[model samples]
Target: MMYKKLFLLSGLVLSLILVGCEFTKKTVNNVNLFTIEDDINLGLQVSQEIANDPKQFPILKEKGNEDVYRYIRKITNKILNSGKVVNRNNFKWQVKIIDDIETLNAFATPGGYIYVYTGLIKYLDSEDQLAGVMGHEIAHADQRHSTKQMTKSGALDLLLSAAIGEKEAVKQVVGGIVGLRFSRTHETEADEYSVRYLCGTDYNAAGAAGFFKKIGGAGSPPEFLSTHPNPDNRVQEIEARAKGMGCRGNSTNKTEYNRIKGLL
Candidate 1:
């Protein structure tokens, strides 16, 4: 009877706590309990691990490789600093060029550390497409998708404490961030933001469709695609979105993209 009473009291306390705190449902942009500082520290730790592994995953830090990185930097930074993105001053936005010339993917870690594989870069036709890819990834970061994912998964209680400043848990956190397969709604939301970000910039939002069309389904889906929407249908939606948003007459800058390819 004593044990039963303790359990009841514990439940009552939890209910009272919830009532006092006014705990609400977790929404796309509103469930954020982790502070911005947590994301920055987490991103920096994971990015450092990726940068150090040269044999398994080469960093594009060889001689005369600076210019291409600069080109990518300019594109990513432009979108990051485009004022279309909220909290522009808080993010530590940096783009890393992974030397994997086979894996056609790019991902953004929390607090705006983006990784672009060389294969995807080579596969894209122009710089505008590159910007589209970057913008999509940045949207994920801006939306704090990882934190929301953890919260929805019910692991935020356990992981939040470890995720902050815990180097040993870096792999787990990084894996969750990179391998997170966002829902269809999440994908659509990011796609919309991709168009918006490209709209205000020099790049055409339609360039996003080109990249999606090129590799709609090259191989089996990875973790990022487990919940991803169909790329073929996504291309059509993106194109229509671009037109609806009046994003015509935007520049692709194929000339500069050609130079970037040549430099690589």
Candidate 2:
């Protein structure tokens, strides 16, 4: 009877805790149990894991690759500093380059930790194209899509466990962030936001579609496509949206972009 009473007490405490800190839903579709602080903390934990796992991440050191880092960060900063993103100052907005030349992908952890593979840089034809891709990744984090997806996947129980100081529950949530495949609705939203973010800058607002256009022309699919599932007619849809939004500049900056690509 003692063990049963302890269980009841624990359950009562959890219920009381949740009553004060209930899981809230954003205006967006999914349920997001995490707060902004939670996103930042979780992202930092995942980033530490990536930093420790050199074999898988193989992050390029900034010492020898200062220029490359600067150029990429320039693109990232442009989008973050665009005054369009809501959590612009709240997130870290740091950039890292993964050394793999064959993996054409970039991703952002919640609270703005960005990672780009060297292959993605090399594969793109212009700086604007890279900016487009970066913008999309940024949108995913800014939209809090990862945590929303987690909440839908029955993470509320784990979060409640975490609330009671269960470290392992927190670790499980962190582990799941990296490999998440965003839904088509999230992908479309990211793409649209990418255009909006770049629209305020010099680059073509629809430059992300350029990545899709190039990939469509290629014989095999890119690793980026594996994680970021392309919606049907995505390229056309992005271009049309850019036009409808009256996005102005179309600077590809291919010459300077090519020079930087050689550095990779």
Candidate 3:
């Protein structure tokens, strides 16, 4: 009986390993363990938990900040509808602008939840720049960077703990996300997605590259810029990506962006 039990347990572990190692055929961000559904549920659970923490919620929250959020949603909706992304139909997309203007940061979770600081919006010069940031973040969400990172960063253990209903494991996953940064390869993949998503839209394909150039030139990297690859390296790659796409004569929408800033 003991020998049979051990065999069954080993088989279960091996099966889980196989599931996690299953690879998709996509050329970008293809390596992942969690199914789209698993990631979506994980993201929703974490987002809800984070939203419940009063200290965790940004000041002003989303209730009185509809205008800023509306502008962000407009950009996100347009990009999402561009049909350039994978797993598009698998998740419900949403975007929010945090009230903090000094943070200069933005991030997206596994599902479709994206958050941008007011500072990134104010710091940028044009709607194209905003699109650049938004597109990059949307790519992060679209590509399931959070889950990829989690899987790479001990999320397998967390998943097991979660299977056993370990609350601390859930907390650890949430806390880990706040400082999560993608690997260079993953960052590049997300950038590629950003460039592609912006191409057919009203925004320029090089918006992301331009934003990287500005941040690099400015010399004071914000938290958003901190975890990314060196701005110079990213800018060069983004330029190359933009050129490969044969994109030209893009709109910057500086006037409209200024108005959005004013709304904030």
lDDT tens digits, residue span 106-150, model 2 = 888877889999989999999888998899999989988776655
Of models 2 and 3, which has the larger TM-score?
2
TM-score pick, better of 1 and 2 = 1
CA lDDT, every model vs. true structure: 0.70, 0.75, 0.67
Q: What RMSD does each model have against the real structure? A: 7.3, 7.1, 6.3
Q: TM-scores, in order shown? A: 0.83, 0.82, 0.81
- TM-score of candidate 1 to 2 decimals: 0.83
Model 2's alpha-carbon lDDT is: 0.75
Give the RMSD in angstroms, all C-alphas superposed, for model 2. 7.1
Candidate 3 per-residue lDDT, tens place, 1-264, comes to: 433442344222432332232233234334566778776776676666567664764734567667766777888887887788776788767666666777677777777777788878888898777787778877877878766654543345564453343666556555655555555556677778888888868678878877777777565554346444778888787778888888773888887788878988
In Å, residue 136's CA in model 2 sits off its true spot by 0.5
Best-matching candidate per TM-score: 1
Lowest lDDT 10-mer window, candidate 1? 14-23
Candidate rank order under TM-score: 1, 2, 3
Candidate 3: which stretches are off by over 4 Å?
1-30, 59-64, 160-166, 217-228
